[model samples]
Target: MMSINFEQLKERSLVIRKRYHELERIHHESEWTVEEDALAFLTDAGLVGRHVMSQQGRWPKENTEEELKHKIGESIWWLTILAERMDINIGEATESFLTKTEKLFEK
Candidate 1:
C-alpha cells in the first residue's frame, strides 16, 4: 500500500492557497474576516460531504470516485485558506485535535 504523509499534505495547503489567491474572483486573505472565511470553508466542506454521499449512492447526481476525490481536495484547500487568513497553524491544530480525541476516549 502507498503511504500518505499528513505533514507533507499540510505544507502543500499553503501552495494551494497562493495559487487560488491568484485566480479571478477569489478574495485575498486580508480582505476577509476570520468568521467570513470560516463560513466559506464550512460551505465547501458541506459540498464535500454531499459529494461523498453521492459517491456512496446515498445522494442524488451521478458521482464518481474522481469527483469525490476532487471535492475532498478542494475542501482541504479552503480549510487551509481559512487557517492562513486566521493566522492558524494547521499542523498544530490537526495534532491538537488528534490528541484531544485520543485522550477523550482513553480508558
Candidate 2:
C-alpha cells in the first residue's frame, strides 16, 4: 500500500472542507456557530471511540477493525473541519502533540 504525506493530507482536507462549506452555504439558512461545529466534531469522535471499544468487546455492538478504521478516517476529516474553523494548523498541531507526548513519556 502507498502512504500519504502530511502536506497531501492537509491539501485534501482543505479541499474537502471547502466543498462541505459550499454545500452548507447552499443548503442551510444560517451559518453554524463555532460551538455547534465543535459539538459535531466531538460527536463523531465519540462514535469512532465507541466503535473501537465495541470491537474490543467492551460493548454490545458489533464492530470490526476495518469499520473502526473507516470511522477513524471520518473523525479526522471532522477534526480538520473544526481545526480550520478555529484557525489551527492540523499538520503542525499533530506534530506538536506527538512531540509533547514523546517528551512526556520518553517514547
Candidate 3:
C-alpha cells in the first residue's frame, strides 16, 4: 500500500469529517461549525466511544462488524493536528516510546 504524507492525509481527513458532520446533521445530532468546535466534539466522542467499547469488548452496534472508517479518519485528523500544533512528530514519539518501553521489559 502507498503511504500518504501528513498534508495529504490531513486534507482527506477534513473531507471525511465534513461528510460525517453532514450525515450527523441529517440525523439531527450535529451542532458545531468551526473546525475547532468539531475537533473538540471529536475528542469527546472518541473518549466516550473507547469507554463503551472497552465495556462491551467490541465496537458499538454502528461498527460492530466493520471498521468505523470515518471515525478513524477523524481520529487521524485530530492526532495529526495535535502533533503539528505541539511541534512533535507522532511517528518519532511512537518510536521513542517503544524503545523506552522495550528497555523496561528487557528482563
Top candidate on TM-score is: 2
**Residue pairs in steric clash, candidate 3?**
none
Q: Each model's TM-score?
A: 0.70, 0.78, 0.48
Shift in Å, residue 98, candidate 3: 1.2
Query: Lowest lDDT 10-mer window, candidate 2?
Result: 29-38
Per-residue lDDT over 24-61 for candidate 2, one digit per residue giving the tens place of the 0 to 100 score: 78889565767877887788788888887899899788
In model 2, pairs of residues that clash are none
Question: What would the per-residue lDDT of candidate 3 be over residues 1-107, giving only the tens digit for each residue?
Answer: 69787568656656766786798788877734556654775775676567558547775455432334445545666676556556677667768989999999998
Q: How does residue 2 of candidate 2 score in lDDT? A: 85
Question: Per-residue error at 15 for model 2, in Å?
Answer: 1.4
- Best of the candidates, lDDT: 2
Report lDDT per candidate: 0.72, 0.80, 0.64
Candidate 1 lDDT score relative to the true structure: 0.72
Give the per-residue lDDT digits (tens) of candidate 1, residues 1-107.
Answer: 57556556667776765565566235543545567667877887888888888888898779467877877877777776676667777778889999999999996
lDDT, residue 65, candidate 1:
76
Candidate 3: Cα lDDT at 22? 90
